[model samples]
Target: VAVFTDVDCAYCRVLASHLGGYLADGIALQFIASPLSSRGTPTYMAAENVWCAVHPHKAFIKAYSGGVPAPAPRPCAVIVAHDSQVAHAMGLPGTPGLIGPHGAVLGGYLSPRDLLARLRMDAATEPSP
Candidate 1:
């Protein structure tokens, strides 16, 4: 699944906190940063920093879990801006939008168990190869 997430959104944090459960259910998450904080704000800066981090996934997990240590402003071009643009184009209502493996949009935050159930249902409905 691909999750359009924002670093500052509380529900996004909740989803991130249970990421392991999703993975345990064979749901691999591809996290795309959609910073709710407008450009030039500290929240946006943190998102940018996480994108530029040596270990971006770990940095993102840390940011949502508690806080990400501020890093020196680097010259790396972060993709969070583009991610936000894509989310807008997709007409996503909010952060933590989960796009299923078959491109079904499951908008909003869903508990890991619920999400796993949905994924299983979707898979079962798919035409067999």
Candidate 2:
């Protein structure tokens, strides 16, 4: 599963903070930081700064969940551009959109229970001989 999310959304934070639980359950969860206009437009500037910082991913996760923003931007421009391009290609118009292995797009915030249920449904629909 690929999670499209913004750094500023609490729901997205919850999902990221709890990623280990999903992974422990044998679920492969990949994240696509789909920073929306509300956050991306300005907050992404902060993200860019963090991207330039020593530990981009850690700095991002920390600041994203209400921590202090990083002090400086990193030297890498490609990561920022590439992430934006991927988000645009996926038709991601908002944050917290989830894509399954079969290309199913699930939008908005979902409680862990609901997410598990939906994943189960998707699993059940898989082709098997």
Q: Which candidate leads the pack in TM-score?
A: 1
What are the per-residue Cα lDDT tens digits for candidate 2 across 9-128? 677888777776777766676666555653336666665665667876777677766786666644555666677678788787776778888888766666566777888898898888
lDDT of 1 by residue, 48-91 (tens): 88887877877887899888745735645448788888888888
- TM-scores of all predicted structures: 0.89, 0.74
Residue 31 accuracy (lDDT) in model 2: 65
Q: Model 1, which residues run further than 4 Å from truth?
A: 127-129
Hey, what RMSD does candidate 1 come out at?
1.8
Q: Which residue pairs in candidate 2 collide? A: 49-73, 52-73, 52-74
Query: Once model 1 is optimally superposed onto the true structure by TM-score, how far is the C-alpha of residue 5 displaced, in angstroms?
Result: 0.6
TM accuracy, model 1: 0.89
Q: Name the regions of candidate 2 deviating beyond 4 angstroms.
A: 38-41, 50-53, 71-73
Error of 2 at 60 (Å): 3.4
- Point out the worst 10-residue segment of candidate 1 by lDDT: 69-78
